[model samples]
Target: MWHPGLVDVVYATVAGALLSTAVVAARAGSPHRTPSRTALVAAVGTLGVSFLVQSPAARGVQNHLVADLGQLTGNGTSLVAAYALRVMVLHVRYDRDTAAARARRWLVALVVAFVAMTVLFLATPTVPGRFTSPDAPAGVVAYYLIFTSYLGATLVSLALLLGRYLDTAGGRWSRLSLHLHRAACVAGLIYLAGRVVALLVGRPRLEGSGQRFNLIELGVTILMPAVVAVLFLLGVLIGRGERWLRHRRAYRRLRPLWEAARAARPHAVLPVTGGGARLRLYRRIIEIQDAQLAAAQVLDAAQRRRIDGAIAGAALTGESAAAVREAALLAAGLAVLRDGRAAGGDGGPVTGAADQEVDLSAAVARLERVSAAWTGSPVVHRLAAPPEPANPR
Candidate 1:
């Protein structure tokens, strides 16, 4: 009985779209970005052109042969979008640098193609008829042929690319990529076949065959591709969803253990037995896990490893790890306090200990309670990373 709100679907779709778009943006930065995303964007655009551009031009088609000249003209955009998407998907899947270059070349080919389609529609003559109107019979045929040929060419090339990719991908990535590409190809073919069917079937509506054909086309052709599009999109989303879910589940699943550690410990402050008040602080800094998730006890081991790696990689990446180190140190200081060493309020003044007014006991108590009452019931780790200077260096 619980249905998702309209906003939820919209947000999910938008997030999916954004996920694809981010790949495009990343493609711009990293040649390693998959071309499948680019193709998906284009595939959607091509279908959009049929509904958004061509369908609207339905008016006046009965009277004027070239009544919807603009609709025909708009084929240019669809051609470019579809071609790019199909080609890019192949390229990404197959690691085809040539495909990228070929994509640019084919884009130029589209202008030439449109010009040819326009000239044929304008000059060439045909008999006045029902669906094959004389205003531009040659144009229509040429357009169909060109579009069909494009589909054939694009599909074959993509199949080749996919074949090459399958041979190379070898394992998990290959399996996923293979499926994604296969679905994409099926989607492309479905749309292309639908358009082809519509043109053929729409020609005879007056004979009753036309209506039947249109109906059949709508189901068998039109919606078939739409269905394929839906499936393809779902697959993409499922892949992303699985990744997101894995991280989330891991975090949730591991959360309890982390929190249990904190719960079991009677003292929150690190038991600072030596002048090394900084030691506890250091441990806290490392265990804090970026002051966000670990303290809240929702951090997963994967996330923990990621944070650890980030810390490890900071020097290589030129990122400052001081803040993370500082949080760790603070946590460690709390640990020391629980050990009764910080009885003198931050040890009465170690070099960097008295720098801040953080309530070690209260902070840990509040945080521990939060951990105990976690709705997610995630795990937290004991802080152990060495602390940085309390004053950021």
Candidate 2:
């Protein structure tokens, strides 16, 4: 006996998550609009809708309306495949003029195919029931043919596109995305192929064979939705993992400066309690700013001039020179604080630039480079190191 309970619930949940995530991603990219972005989002969102409506939890009534919706949802899946193909084409060749013409041809084929499928669905005498039901009439064969062919083409195109993407993709996040895309496409193909075969072979013989091959049948029914769920969950996990890695990396790179600041001026330490990555990163930024302010009080003109001269003379150039100079200056300031002496009286307090935009990733990237030389720089050793204790007074 085939019960739809588990598969339906799983489908609904996974579909809901995929849709929600895509929506959030789209909204975040509101400033950048492109035809490819629109196609990809629509494709994904339509597939989500197809899954959502067919779920057993959503089939509240077994009336003709509900059954028609189920059938219509099948077509939605085909439409999704069409749009997915278009998305792939656009991704590979983003030329608007040429892509628009090609996309229109695809769209027209999809519409014509959809119309044919819809007409067959209405004319067919399918029992108002779950997708796996054996009560479908002869006309259902035509419906499955149209549905399966379009869906198969879409999946094939998607798989090919993902293969290309995987070849070009570098780093962890891009690899993760490609893996999920391929896995999902494979699962979709298996599910659609099974439906096509089941329809062609007729239900009575299929049910009889199911008794002998119970495990395969069970796998076919249960594993489709399960794979889809895994795909969605993997995407969410990878995204979160990427973010955590970035935050931790940034935090670690800034640690040397943060430690030095805390030692030289304890008052610069912020009263930060427990928090997530973003909050912790923010507090660390604030504390570092406070340390810079405190160091500025004792940092004198001669030391500043000397650091400037060293910066001008350093072998490094361009952005590297600028970044190294900042690190060297901060190091010198720390030394002055540590020694409790300077060539002259304190300069006025320094603070974070009010006019400058603070990009966390960019800041972290610069600091990571600076960290490579922070402890070893000769200027830092000369200026920031604590004065040796005099012979016992």
Pick by TM-score: which candidate is best?
2
Per-residue lDDT of model 1, residues 176-266, tens digit only: 7467756667676766666665555445453646455546644643355445545555555555555444334333433432443354343
- C-alpha TM-score for every candidate: 0.46, 0.63
Candidate 1 error regions (>4 Å): 1-39, 42-46, 56-66, 70-74, 90-99, 124-138, 159-184, 187-221, 250-393
Error of 2 at 57 (Å): 4.3
Q: After superposition, how far is residue 132 of candidate 2 from its true place, in Å?
A: 5.4
Candidate 1: deviation at residue 153, Å?
2.5
Residue-by-residue lDDT tens digits, candidate 2, 1-393: 556786676777767876886686566423336677677666666667766765666554434464656657645674764666565566567578777777777778788778887787777655555344444666677777777787677777778878887898766895896789678778878877766665556557765565654555566655775585467457555855777777877887778878887887776686667766755765676677666666676666665676667766666676566556566667766777776765343664433233133766655666655555576566545545433436896
Best by lDDT: 2
Task: Report lDDT (CA) for all predictions.
Answer: 0.47, 0.65
Q: Which ten residues in a row have the lowest lDDT in candidate 1?
A: 342-351
